[model samples]
Target: MSRLPAVFATGLILALAGGAAAVQRLPATPEPARLTGWPQPAEMPGFGDDGTLGPAEISDLTEYVLALAGAQRDEAAVIRAVPLYQTHCAACHGLGGEGAEILGTPDLTRRQFRVVTGPADIRLQIWHGDDGRGPMREAQRRSGRPHG
Candidate 1:
């Protein structure tokens, strides 16, 4: 009886862990999360140029600040982002969307192009250094420039 109970408990634990892993594997959704009394960027200087910046620039700028998970330009997200990249990012990333390894460009091919796993991590990176210079530097650099 003791052996049976121990085996049952182990199986239950394994099942739960598998379920948790499946949950983690699910596609990530990006949305603006609100915080209490956070100051507005609009009110600050050196931002919001009253439409002086081009639309593509606006998109890149937004992507830079959003700090969301799976921030890559996926099929779902690409529908909205490709036009933006074509106008702004293509020059650096290239016509095939292959980022410039020669000039430290980032490949936005996957959900993990850069891991922002949480708000705190993303904030620290944005304010400080991103493994080196730009966002997703570690992931992109380490991956050996795979498609993304």
Candidate 2:
């Protein structure tokens, strides 16, 4: 009859009821729905859907992209890249490529990188995110931008 015992009993009953409801709601096996509207998996410029890229392929692609970048080396190119970088890279890389230490994002402005050594390396990293690290694959897939 005490208020304390009554409250305790009510809590125990609610917890057991909630547990039963949770168990009932759980599926025996999860089957995720396919997103028909999304792009069908296709081989990207420098990589594949499975995120594989040979050294030769990566080198060729890197050279091509760097050449293009070099050709467009001007104020206009920098201006264009700024917005794209902000939209895609800023969340993890920071406004000035300083990187988010908490997220394990490397400082882009540094002379040496944890995973990348040059322009080609940067492209590879951007295209195929480090397996143990975070992902840009979803961003790349959604953006539909051609990757180097």
Candidate 3:
């Protein structure tokens, strides 16, 4: 065989040495993956007809809704809220969660509603009865269960 060039021999040795070092540095368990956080959103479970989260849907909706809070829309919260409105709310609040005038639902016009802040306050409206026009009060009356 022809004598190898000194530069080529040196490079080959260095490459082999670097590769060996890399193999040693690599972890057998891959550092246990560190579990940076929740799995990728694309891996989320699909939302069922009832609008409940599956392993996939839970991951997806969480990502979507959280993303909306920072987005620009007529009301990103309202848009992201479609699922919630369709679920716990549509029966009394109307399809869009727009207050019902006939039932005395509180018109969501910011001008109409009083200054409000905090999630519990909003949750209270959802939990208690916003009988401004919605059937929340009636549901409470008929069900005789907690206002949910």
Candidate 4:
């Protein structure tokens, strides 16, 4: 009976030790880099006959824009969107979201937009340009570029 107890304890210890070793050997999940500024991409998405921005990218960019307009910021999403804004919007909206009068793009840094009232409105603008300019969606579909 005493021998049985010793065997059970030994088996428990061995099982625990084996589990610890297995845990040590397991691969760790990679952590995303700590981004202090915007992330830059090697290649920008092309405004080809098909729209370049994906659904996720548009969501991230919208969140980032809201942050720029003084809304609650999603730091991670904002960082991810920095390069996207530079490549896609900066040409007309300017780096600071100052916007261009000639291009008829509205200033994004302001809290109140002439056309955009909320997130959906911003997404609509991204998909379709403002009234002064031709619809970005149709232009991208037809010519692979925004028609200012």
Best by TM-score: 4
lDDT values for all models:
0.44, 0.53, 0.42, 0.65
lDDT of 3 by residue, 1-148 (tens): 6566987999999999999999999878764443245332111111332234333323333333333334233344455556754664455445534555444444442213332343323333344434344323334355553322
Q: Weakest 10 consecutive residues, lDDT, candidate 2?
A: 41-50
TM-scores for the candidates: 0.30, 0.40, 0.30, 0.52
Quick one: best lDDT, which candidate? 4
Candidate 2 lDDT over residue span 34-117, tens digit each: 545543422222243345554444444334334333432344445545655665556666777676554555655553255444
Model 4: per-residue Cα lDDT over 1-148, one tens digit each: 4699899999999999999999998669856554444343212223322467776677778887788788887889899999989988897678988876544456778853654557765654555445443334343456444321
In the predicted model 2, the residue pairs found to clash are none
Give the poorly placed runs of model 2, Cα more than 4 Å off: 1-75, 133-147
Q: Comparing 3 and 4 by lDDT, which wins?
A: 4
Model 2 CA lDDT for position 116: 43
Q: What TM-score does structure 1 among the candidates reach?
A: 0.30
Q: Candidate 4 — which pairs collide?
A: none
Kindly state the number of residue pairs that clash in model 4.
0
Clashes of each: 3, 0, 10, 0
lDDT of 1: 0.44
